[model samples]
Target: MSVFRYTLLASVVLPAALSTVPALAQQAPFPADAGESDGADTIIVTGRVQRLYRAEQTTVGKAAEDPMNIPQSVQVINSELFTDQGARDATDIYRNISGVSFFSYAGVTFRGFRQDQSFYDGQRGNPFIGFSVPQLFNIERVEVLKGPAGLFFGPGSPGGIINYVSKTPSDTSSLRMVATGGNYDRVGISAEATGPVDADGIITYRVGGFYEAMDPYRRNTTNKAKIADGAIAIRTNEGGKLTLQATIYDNYLRANRLRGVLVDDAGNFLTDIRWNANEPTDFLHLKSQAYQARYETSVGDRVTFDAGVRYFDAREAQKYHEPRGLDPANPDLVRREFRDQIRPVHGLSFMTNATARVDLLGMEHKFQAGADWYDEKNVLDSRILRTGVTSLSLSNPVYGGAAEGDAARAALLPFTTTDTRTKRQGVYLQDQISLTRSLLLVGGVRYDHFEDKVTTSTGGAVSNRSSYRDGDVTLRTGLIFKPLPDISTYVSWSQSFEPQAAASQDANAGGPFAPVTGNQVEGGVKTQLFEGRLQANLAAYRIVRRNILQVDPSLPPVNGVDQLAPIGEVTSKGFEVDLAADITPDWVLLVNYGYNDTRITGTVAGQAITNAVGDRFANAPRHKVGFWTRYQFPVLDAAFAFGGEHVSSRISLSGQSVQPYTIFDASITKGLGFAELLLRVDNIFDKVYAASGFSAQSGHFPGEPRTFLAELRVRF
Candidate 1:
């Protein structure tokens, strides 16, 4: 079906279903006069508890299930935890998660693998496209599901998936306003309000927006963003609910897409940490619009159904001076090249699922079945201009001397213009069976079909056209044993697959490359201690990935073009511990630690320059530790929070070594009845470290320096 028809069907079916609510109410699936709360209840609670940082249930698996019983490594970071830390973007909350670290903008290294795709409300799509970071103003919580999730989320990186849960309209009427100011001339204001629109309380609405601008710590750089979000919910008398949501985002960055500070071969800094190579006119801009519709209902006392549709459109344009390397003849100067890129993307997705509870042969079972479809088109128009005379000095830098204006653009060389389309569809089934009171078995399987088509042109003439189509089946199974009501142990196995991009294929190969596949085995234990006020999870896992595409060194080049082959394999083994506890009524703490070891176990015999046996994966740290604790003083209505993170040294993709670093942060909060004030400081020690790096020549990204922020929030 066409995207328009699918959207039209959803728009028509929702109101039609609501019209039948009166007739369905006659059946009375739920007791009308019981005076007991049903599943759907909107109640806002004030104050804090031990569970404030811990989420008991999650929808990441396409159903509402307890994380302790899922037999996998799952973690959640709620708004309360990040809000207290003065978080401005998604990366600020990564320290609370285990086995996760920064890779680049809006990207992370997950369990020794790199992934950028994120799910919104359990649907597959990303609104924050290339180089754009996700803002946290409209998010309710962030959930991370570790290991392969192909059985539920479809083809993706084998590492795992990140899900963003949005704040929806509530029946409870409330208004919240916040004003914030920070170092580097940063300032922002936002307001959010939700309430019922009708006297009967059947219709509800939520609206929020924020605008912020700042000068970053880096020299000659600036950042600005504007966002608006709105949502509406309608409830039927029979307990069915329909919701519609819309969001718009505009972001601008000037001289902010920095490659990093230059470094020497021995990993020593060659320049100041805040040094930048981009010109004042260099900028990156992105604009996006997204819309979604969701409907949920219960078929009977033992069954529930959910369906959702989402459409997104985004455009990103960037112009920057990319640092190449040190000049061959003059080591004191760095060579540079100019790049211009324009990318536009459109995406549509649909998802539906149903869960049923049944009993067979004296054993209880929970079964779920779902199907999903996603379509996206991405277009890229890029150009580059290179000149030997464009260089920057190491000791003294000068700007406005490089190429600019229409004349420079007209002299630029066309790199490539390509239009790519991807379509994916999947169906999955899962069952959770209880054989006895202490033992449970869970199993699931999924079938997915993926298609990719790319068209490339140069000077308005078609240069190359490539198409790929393939299908695969992924499986998952787990067994859980409960020794006590508060303790559980489980083991699981899962598989995943991801198709290679068209651009990665060699034009001389004349055949589509095989998709990469991965599988993992894991075991874990979960416990609740201290009268259920503390939750702890420990897990160990090993993953193997095969069929990696690489250049074929054995075969001679076909007309000076390299040949491609799939003869690479990698293995990653790791363990993690996550803990959340409330030592006392006024004290809450969160701690996590991770140990990962990733290496290339197999590769082509002749390929020694890039992939080699026993080589460590890039950006995969072997050890990581994080901790945060907050203490509240009831007498003064105030709180104090302290947290920090430490990451072990890592290797860059180019075999360059990066040093380890530790950072500390603290915050203070004062409650004033209807208002609250917060003061936070990051990098308290002003430590200098490299967050990540591609190579010593291109530069290494530097960690933020000491910074301070103050915020005032009023609620009514």
Candidate 2:
């Protein structure tokens, strides 16, 4: 039998066999009624003592609903999971999520789509950039909602969205600190504190931050970053609350490489090398800051309103040498190019929401209405100073050869500049209706209007200006049935829309292209078995995306660009199973498996864009699996965890194949009187592989080698 079959069987049979075991105090019992508010009922699962995988409530749907009550796939990763896995960013956590892949700076891949946008406290005001990895020191938890969420998050990729909930102020005094040291000359320190500010206990505050520096695994590569976050919460006399939060982050990187070694036609790695592709003098610097203010109040016992405003500003500057291609004269020598760029961006958002719960016609209904507006402006100045002639040896490379100082910087002058602005406004309404004691229905609709404009300046002259506008409507509906209090079966249908800026300049007689539309149909089953200690979920879904821009093969190139037409469609279907269990007081288990088949089903007649209709989506693996287990030793007061990740062969956009590889990892943590020590090792097998990529030159990013870290955490 295949590994997938065995995993599926284990996922189906483990809960049944474990149900006979006695319950433990690791996880709290589920609430008896679903109508209760999630104020004090919300459970925060951490790794300090007993850590459970299950989460009670999530805001993925723009509402605090029970995970079992929702008719969709929702995965929650608590702080405990973060600490055990040593997850500092999305890349660290992607291994545990089935069907999620990382492609370097291309962002994250989910459900056969590449997703780069994220939601912070359910707000969109930041970019998912390579230098701007999310800082987890101030994060409470991360909720991942799979499938199209346009009705709640507005226009976005059909792959779904990642929501990060920031840590908030508490009414109790607490302080914690962590110091870490690891291979590659890594060292870091982080601290957090929260407490009441006044005698009445009506006001509270939280302050936390982290500073980390590392000499990366690749030769001549280094990274350093610092983040600070603060929040204040005020309780009004009339049963209302206000929160103000701010954050600042600065990151610097030297000799950061974007791609790796080249591969031959047979997908054989030509270079047995691991070093920075960039020159030693290259550097990337980024700085960003954000502020948010929100107020929430209750009008009556059943009605509540919330309003918020957020602003973010960021700047990035980078000077690097990029790999171009192999030299025609000698394939052993790789050509290189030099680039210098600077970008500054600003974003603002405003939102308000009202929710009410009422009993009508012998049933209960929860209604919500909200409106949001966002605008972002960006400026880019870039130049390519040199190309082709510069080269590097494939087998061995020596640094410090490239010219540095003002001479090199002066060569990148007279940069081309671009200014772009985008704005979006959306309004939505949703209702969760209880049709019967065991049946629930959810439905929502949203309308979005968006506009984008771009202007370019070349050679100190205003060159061109282009603008586009469009409007779209999205819908979401689901049905959930429960035969047992701990079991739920659900089916859902949803739609998403995203405006296309690429087709705005197409020289075609078909008129302006329409926005891309995506629809999905999904069915799933969720169960809380083993006395609420084990949570299992199985989901199957099919999604179709239409109105994709395809090149017109029938028409010759016009002005060096092929004519475009919006007559393409893509489809993705998959099955996913996830299991999380705290089998006993000392044993914990987490498992996930996914099988995805994504293909381009239709396109303009007799036209192909390198990727054909029958080919699977680039960088999307057909099979993925992850398994992890941890056991705590009573006498030693320590926990040990081991896990492995697997991925099947993947094809790139140019049809270059990426061989499948599996990696193993392990970690151990011991608790003392006031401090906890942890040791973690990744890629324990020391297997050399490529994680994911697109091409031989600009892709084929190499995976990290065997790495280890030791950390000490203290709490007061």
Candidate 3:
């Protein structure tokens, strides 16, 4: 079953766990329990969506029909939810996932982790969020495998990894279209079709594309993207099959980089903003193109192989005055940052899996051995625009797009800039040996070698340069026990490693790469209640990393936030729990919590190098929670959705108590013949607060007020 339908099954598991959803729904919109649909037990519950039916899953690798079960905390965003939710981009797909929030400051957030460190399919899809290009649209479903995934992914984040699955062609010939319009003048249209290439059924093809546009509250109101993707598969009579898929994406953006707000003499934060209240030519612009190619094949009955390659290119430029209060070094517009970048990535990931039955031991074994390689080349040219000192306020939210009449033009500086390119190579072997009818064992080890090199933006300069040894090995072990047909529990542990780029000063001093980092994790998972319809994965994990790297700004002259700080040592640890239930056939519920004990375990600055008595991590809140639910109106054959999301209160500017906040949302959708209609209202009642952790110049601003969207889809 697709991951989505599996999540549908997750919705069914709830009835046996909580029978009090109706009362909760009637009260607060963001009720701790989440939604109001806790009544119905007729939904036929099955396996969770481990495999989502969409364009991308086919890109990860070929899965064996009866392959050994992988022990990991995996979640899927299925297509059924896709059409129902009208998800325009990768960010929207996780609307109901708890503790997972999208931070425009960087990228998508999981628990307290950012998307920059995650993976795409099983490749090196991770990139710095602000500049990372997006490749989504005709996606199949998104797969999230939690825990230290160094073996599965390359390096960077030790928090976990996320993969986006693309769509693939099938033997069925059919076409589907989806179109929608909503608040913020948002509109989107997408079409897809699958058909057989030959009457003999040897070849098949699937093609899909989409166009979308919207106006947000950010500086640049116009946001749009266009995508085209297709896949082809060939089946042979000898029990072998091959599938290949290709995709291209285009994006257009014009938005003021909403920096932080400015605090006044009285401590009041300002909102009205502009490129430069003193300059009229400031502008923001960026456009990109991305392409992906994948291939997969299955041999005989005991072995399978999958591989893929991807490339991306973008021409991006942005001109924005550094915000006043936000930049501690200089509040005034001493200089501005103008940037241009063209980034392309080339990488390949493939694996082979085989099963063997041992007669002497009377046991069956599934052995999976695979190799992986990745490389990324980043080209950047940034120009600093200087214009002495400009006018007031970068924090004030400027709504009218005002004009500053007699302002001077910013003078351009001819300084060339550049960055170091990164590359990684890895290989692994895993074995799952089934010992008894009720027990199974899994174990594996992996090794990776990574290299980074720096260069000048203009090719006029070169250096044998700074480098570091980024090679390490890790192992994974797990045990599964199924005493009952409906009850299964497993305990698993995995190890991962990462080596960060050198510090700026070190680089300037001809410094070399830093020490390689390592993280070890262990946790137990449980899939319980009601014939496997309900699943609650409770995991207690401690991520230990050595040679921890952190930027510090505590050096005498610098007591505030610094863009240029020294790299120090640190260790972050946390715990996570997620529960999904079908509750009843007519009602569904989802709830999750994350407790991250993130601290500057070690820093050279002694007592207050990083965490002060009141200082919190940049964007992480110790406590994170989210809940969502949908209940079907049996009489109308439609579902009504409602839920609330929240983050506990925390400090923003080293001081100030910006209270904790929560927002509620609701919607309903009905399936009618070949067409389905959906209606949703977000931020119901318009509770205002920063959805992003960033607060107002004062303390906090209201989140997106009441907003709604209506959509429809058709298939033949």
For each candidate in turn, the TM-score is 0.91, 0.91, 0.79
| Most accurate candidate by lDDT | 1
Candidate 2: where are CA atoms >4 Å away?
1-49, 127-131, 237-239, 299-301, 403-412, 502-509, 554-562, 605-614
lDDT of 1 by residue, 371-396 (tens): 99999999998877765436888778
C-alpha RMSD by candidate, in order: 11.3, 6.3, 8.3
lDDT of each: 0.81, 0.78, 0.54
lDDT of 3 at 252: 56
For model 1, state the Cα shift of residue 264 in Å.
1.9
lDDT of 2 by residue, 341-436 (tens): 889998999988888998999989989999999999988988876633358777787666554542275464688899889899999999889999
- Taking the tens digit of each residue's C-alpha lDDT, what string does model 3 give over 410-460? 223443556657777877777777788778888988888877766664434
Ranking by lDDT: 1, 2, 3
lDDT score, candidate 3? 0.54
Q: For model 2, what is the alpha-carbon lDDT of residue 388?
A: 34
**Residue 502 lDDT (model 1):** 70
> What local lDDT does model 2 show for residue 419?
87
